[model samples]
Target: MPVYKVYLDQVFLGNLVMNYAILWAAAKLSRVPVHTARLVAGAALGAAYALAVFIPGAGFLQSVWFKTVISAGIVAVAFSPVTVRMFLTCLGCFFLASFTLGGLAIGIIFYLNSGRLSSWDGIGKVIEGNFWPGILLGLIALWAAGRGFAALLKKGKFENLFRIPILINSGGKQVRVEALLDTGNQLKDPMTQSPVVVVEYNSLKSLLPEQVQAGLERDGEADIWNILGSLSESSLSSRFSAVPFQSLGRANGMMLGFRPDEVVIERQGKLARPGRVVVGIYRNKLDPEGSYHALLGPNVLELTG
Candidate 1:
């Protein structure tokens, strides 16, 4: 008879980390906001499930139905308030990431030491005590693969305009809004050469001064110009600028632009700062359907970290 010793701490900790990674990857794939504390709590739930097999009367945990329920529970905890479509997408990505990583680890372990690999119980057993180095190397490989995949996607079918979440912070005020990445948008501030992100005036209303808001509420280029001229004597003169643009039915138009303290774009579970960017205020709605409130220039995405 042969015996296998599984460290309980390793089982809990290993599954915890693995669960977190899978949840994060799934969130990125589903393009949803990530809550770190919720993810950690969800991972803890998964780790608890992994330990249930050790209990005397916990045989029900091994059933396929029970396993499905647990998986759903994990996702619900991590990404609550998701629609049915989004929930399905998140679950699919979760399974895909889990299978891909699990299969890769198993293949590598088998290729290295087929004789030592016998029965797979918990994830800790697959990692064992001596396989930490291989795991670390595998993580590095996955990261490189992810970067390459992102580049390929950019040039692939996803090159078209897509919605993304962005945060604009100025004067200790931050506004989070959905923005469309427009490849056709090449608008930039002529003075500083910073890319201009056109946001609906209502979307940025909270961040603007009372005088600026008053001017934006009115129509016509004359009022906009008046506001720009008036701001020179105001305290916000340094933060304001003029961005010239040409659009359909409008030529040589100027937009009210202001410099934000910081702009952070979240893509694939990562925060990308596109250096300095100007926020252009548009009095009218950019999208009639209200799908997105802001427009992002392609160059900004390229400069993101």
Candidate 2:
């Protein structure tokens, strides 16, 4: 057996520092609103708990359930007025931030002590090497990473980070795809002048008749409007439309469009329907990895709000 001792003042100080770090990291990573006074008070309360739990008669504080409740209290005080879903999201980010900071601290400590640890014989010294430097460096690295991520989000690619599920119901046949919201998509229906969602040929090909698919395959998009005309006799006649546009290195281009009976967007456990939108068919893959099968333009994507 080994002897163990913890000082009250040390526990209080350590917990204060750690709680603030965790709170800051979680807020930055999770994008949760922060009230400075509330957060500071919450961290202080957490530190008080640390000191309180170490008191000689505090046996109940050692239980896992008690600790979990304590964590919830700390989070609630720090980020008040948060929805349950958002609170859970913040809690997950808190855990992630804690783990990442721990790993970062440990890695820096190990790196700083590498080859110089030959004189030390115990695990305590190995794990506890140069605490202040490790903490300072870890925090600096965290801040830098947060800044880099924020910069990336500001680069007009924020919409591409999340994939939204959209269901297209045409003539009773429904096709669903994960859509990447593209800010650069300016394609719109020339007639109604509504927004258009660009989808791959393969994904929406099932929504078309076999004859139309054969015509598109034969003439390679040149006969897409003709194919839509032929589909006039089929069940998918009115669902088909066309759009004309000009792009880089190409002039006088046309894309096949589909006017589905209903277009539903699934996001955050809610389904939304947007009006005056057409689906544009793309001949090639928007993303080669197939991470998202469809691309949503701003005109229609805003309707999800």
| Structural similarity to truth (TM-score) of each candidate | 0.50, 0.52
Report the C-alpha lDDT of model 1 over 169-283, residue by residue, as the tens digit.
Answer: 9889899989987644667788898888889889999999888987877655547667878788888888887788876237788888889899999898889999899888888
CA lDDT of 242 in candidate 2? 78
Candidate of highest TM-score: 2
Off by over 4 Å in 1: 113-135, 147-157, 161-305
In every candidate, how many clashes are there? 0, 0
Residue runs of model 2 more than 4 Å from their true location after superposition? 1-10, 116-121, 156-158, 163-263, 266-305
Residue pairs of candidate 1 with colliding backbone atoms: none
What's the lDDT for all of these models? 0.78, 0.76
Reference-based lDDT, residue 213, model 2: 76
lDDT of 2 by residue, 1-305 (tens): 75667677877877788778788878876665577887787789889988887678899997989887888888888987665556776778777877787788778888877876666564457775477678778877777776777677545346456678899887788989989765445577987787788888888888877876786677434587677778878866776787876541256888888787778998778889996678887777877667788877666866656
